[model samples]
Target: MSDYLIVGGGVIGMMMARELSTAGADVTLVDRRGCAEESSWAGGGIVSPLYPWRYKDPITALATWSQSSYVLLAQELLEETGYDPELRQKGMFMVSVEDADDARRWAAKHHRPLTTVDADFLYQKEPHLKENLGEALWMPEVASIRNPRLGRSLRQSLVGRDNVTVLEHQPLESLIIEGEQVKGIKTHKGEIRADKTIIAAGSWSGELVKPLGLNVPVEPVRGQMMIFKAPQGLVNRVVLMDGRYVIPRNDGRVLIGSTMEHTGFVKETTEDARASLYETAINIVPALADHPIEHHWAGLRPGSPEGVPFIGAVPGYENLYMNAGHFRNGLVLAPASTRLLADQLLGRTPIIDPAAYALSGRVTSG
Candidate 1:
């Protein structure tokens, strides 16, 4: 019997496996498809929330904590796997000034630096941007990572671990529950027993735990993205306008995304979504209009009621835990979120208070 059985092979599940295995726990991670092929692979990789000032303190607290630990984690992964997640500190430019005052107030309250830049300064910073965009807010501390690479490196780093076993192509059929405790899971292949089970299955977590009478309130929110093959210096930093964003990779690939549609579990990409994303990308940096779209894809984010992830034990189940519902910020929040869950499961003092993300907590939408 394994010490823990984790259902989900995204970044969150992989991170939890790495942590628990390092701590000498027997861990088995099972995924429907392959690891990191879901939302974790398809995200824009921004290390900060979409609009930091617009979220509640609970959400911001988790994001801020996770952002601080990303650099160190990236370095460790690079050293171990020779794959750099490309943790870049290029900062982010928020183009819309409608919420500038609210953003400034939130920044002050959170001790985060937020500067308003005029058009000239913005042009100097991002020369590729179209002219006459007025002023923008500069979040100098914001950073990004290549999330797919991060997920790959994390799985690679755990490949040689003696205590970890990764099972792919195994869809979880149901849970092996005895009264209030979950003994194990029934996958497509066979039964695997474990002392504890964790539902890190992202958007599918709600269905996985419904038999236990736990309402995780996690659902799939489809987001589509378009990749543009541009010059390396096409966009100097991450450019954001409204809800759409354009992220530049170290290579000549610029990622333009996305749409937040509550369309259940559908992960299909639409021509309308592509056109909208392309128009938005061009509006931010007009030069991108000339670049050819190399790829277009969509992923389902595990969105919750208020965008805050659940990262603790269920109310009545002692052996079952959860770490899903991160919405679009899964990659950014994975390190901290997994660490907190691992600490609680291992009976150690968590680095952060886990009460804010409790399963029974009230949803607060800011």
Candidate 2:
């Protein structure tokens, strides 16, 4: 029996396995499909929440902690594995912010730098934008990672470890529960026993635990995005307006995203969503209309109450744990969330208060 069994090989599970395996624990990570091919690959890789002022304290705490660690973590991953998870400080422009006071309050409380800029500043920074773009909130410290590369680096690192095993294309059949103890998981191939089991199955987490009489309020929310093949330095930074965004990658590709639809595990990309995203992208930067639409895809974010994730022990099972339900911020929050779960499992002092992300506490707060 391994020391840990992680179901779902997305960012959360891979990070969890990486953490525990680094601590000299034997870990086996299984995924229904290819690891890191789900939401972890399809995200915009923004290291912060869509709007920092919109979320509560818990989300802020996790995001801040994870953001702070990403630079070093990316470096470590690159050194360990030869893949570079392009972590770039491209900053962010929040155009047409509704409540400046709330944003200022959140920034001041969190010690994040925020500046107000007029249309002149917007045009001067990014000349391709449409006219009368108006004022925006500039956060110069914001950064983003190329999450698909990050996923590859993480998978390589995990596979290289002597204490970790990764099984892809293996579907989890059910949890092996005896009384209140979850021994391990039953995959399509066979059952694997472990001292502890963790469910990091993203949107499928709710269904995985429901048979055990736990109604974990995690559901799939579909988000679609389109990419434009623009030249390098065309779009300078990440631009957010009206809950939609355009992210410029180091390579000439720019990302335009996304629509939040509670469509119940439907990962299909709709023409309506693609057309809407294109319209938004062109309006934000008219030059994008000249560029070719390279790719349009969709991902399922694990939606939870107020966009907070549950990252602790399961309610009824002593040997079972969870690190899912991160919604849209999974990539941004993965490092800190996995670290906290590892801290709890290994009896180390947690990086933050464990109660806020605990399953029972989340249920109560919800």
Candidate 3:
């Protein structure tokens, strides 16, 4: 029996396991697929929330905490696992934005560095962009990591840990419940017992805990993305307009994404999404139209109500916990979410207030 058993081996599960195992607890992490092959791999890896000023305080708190930790974490992972997650500090530019005053106020309140630039400034920064876009919001502190590389680093790091046991392709059949407490999980191979169990199964998290009469409210929100092989310096930074974005990798590959379709577990890529994304990418930078689309894919974001994740002990169970329902902010929020969960499990001081993320009596409405 392990001290902790994590059901999903995505980034959340791996990070949780890392946190616990580092604190001298034995951990066993299992996944239906291999680690980091799901939404963790499919994300664009933007470190900040899209339009940071628009979200409520709960999200801002988590993002703020995680952003401060990412730089150190990335360096540690690279040194330990010999895999670089390509964490880059390329700033993001939101062009032709509305609610400029709200953005300013939010930045000032949070003490994050933000600036407003006119069209000339925007053109000077991003020469390939469409001209005459007016004032845009620039966040120079924002960073982005390559999602696939980050996944690889996490998997490698977990495998190298002596106290961590990874079980791949082991699907969780059911939760072992005994008198209102979850003892462990029953996988296809056999029953694995643990002192504590966590359901970090991403979009499939709600289904895993439904038999326990707990409504986690995590659904699969499908997001489709495509990549173009462009020149390395074609697009200088992360560019966003409306809900879509264009992220430029250092190796001359530009990523364009995504559409938030509320499709249930349908991970298939659609022509409509591809066409829409392509149109948006070309409109942002006309030079991108000349490059052929190298790849197009989709991932299921674990859509939580109000974009807030449940990250504490389950309400009705003694030994069960949850860390799911992050929606589109999973990659950006993983570090803080895992730390909060670990802090609670280890009986240490939590980095932030835990009341906002409780599973019981959660305010799902805005």
Candidate 2, residues 148-182, lDDT tens digits: the string is: 99999999999998899999998988888898899
- The Cα error of candidate 1 at residue 90, in Å, is 0.9
Between prediction 1 and prediction 3, the one with superior lDDT is 3
Report model 1's TM-score to 2 decimal places.
0.97
Q: Mark the 10 consecutive residues where model 3 has the least summed lDDT.
A: 357-366
- List the pairs of residues colliding in candidate 1: none
lDDT of 3: 0.91
Error of 1 at 244 (Å): 0.8
Per-candidate Cα lDDT values, in order, are: 0.89, 0.92, 0.91
Candidate 2 has a TM-score of 0.98
- Candidate 3, residue 340: the lDDT equals 96
